[model samples]
Target: MRSIQRLVTLGAAAAAVVVLGACSAPSQEPSSATDVPPVPTVAAAGPTTPAVPGSTTAAEVFGPGCASLPTGDDPGSLSSMRLQPVAAAVETNPELTTLNDLIGRANLAGPLNAAPELTVFAPTNDAFAKLPAEQRAALEADPARLATVLEYHVSGTRASAEELRAAGTSTELAGGQVRIGGTGDAMTVSDASGGTANVVCGNVPTGNATVFLIDTVLVPQA
Candidate 1:
């Protein structure tokens, strides 16, 4: 196991270098732990189960994307966010900067955080990047349109992974229906935009909502 130990040491050294570089970098809107692009998911230091509704146990968070989050109890970590409102929790998640900024611009964070129960299909920066240029530009340019699009990603009822798969669909806050398919990490969501988004990391939790990081933005239908 000498090679394995060496690899681990090398990995830690590489991570330290990155941390040092980021610490020395110019200030912008402060980001989650690393400035390096994060995979499409939010904070978690470990994996957990996704099928339990209304549970925010740190041990209940799951998905392949979990590994990318910064470890420990920083404001950006899963354990720290377990008691915070969904909108508040997203504020410190690295992969969700684009979504966080849009929510701020659209002024939807208040409603999202205040809602008693919700299931948020949060899109990552990469997801926004993948959005068609004209569509993304239009949404960004108009707060009203952006609000509708953002609402389209949320459900009024909080649902666990099994519940989502069992129901097959949910009505979004935008008053439109979205179809949910697959189970756990393989789950996918489809909206009126006719594009499908995979749930890269499923069953994340906050005080008032269950969060799922999706790989695509869900556009609202007319």
Candidate 2:
């Protein structure tokens, strides 16, 4: 009877070891496909947006004459041109030689240099050349009259392309009104005598003021 009991106890111990071994073993069953998490998708980059229509940019203010402007490295360039005052800046441009001569003769260069925030509508040499010889001589002979004519070309306030367009008319130091018309490359300025000048080069910034090189000399009414 005792021998039979020992055999039964040994069989029970063997069955418990098998159960423990199965429990301790790693899982062999395959995982479900849904058990893994999905990865997030990345978005592709897009192109830049363009500028708004009808808006005036800095390039627009420079006008078409900028095509003839010297590069920054050139001594004659507008970038180098700004290093000096307006009077000195004008002297650097070969095209404005006549204007420079007139400014010096009239003794207006000193005053122009001293003036703050002035907008000068400088006429090219061709403009002065277009004037009748007798009239030109008479004006040149009289410094006071020449000064008046020169002052008529200047405004106390600095006028940009957009400002001139918005104003339509600007009051000058000569106590006369200058009519500003058109937009962009077609912009024109009219003096008291109804003579109009095309802005060849607009918005040339200097140390003291902005300069617009016009194609015609502006004459104030007597």
Best candidate, lDDT: 1
Please give, for residues 1-222, the per-residue lDDT of candidate 1 as tens digits.
Answer: 222233335546877899999899986654666666645877676755444354456665777777776568877678766778888999988988899999999877766666657788999888999978998888889988788788888877788776788888888867778899976568899988798998887778788788888888887787
For model 2, name the residue pairs that clash.
none
Each candidate: RMSD to true structure? 19.3, 31.9
TM-score of model 2 vs. true structure:
0.71
Instruction: Count backbone overlaps in model 2.
Output: 0
Q: Tens digit of lDDT per residue, candidate 2, span 43-83?
A: 88675421322222234446566667677656546776666
Error of 1 at 143 (Å): 0.9
Which ranges of candidate 1 are over 4 A from the true structure? 1-53
lDDT of 1: 0.78
Collision count for each candidate, in order: 0, 0
Structure candidate 1, residue pairs in collision = none
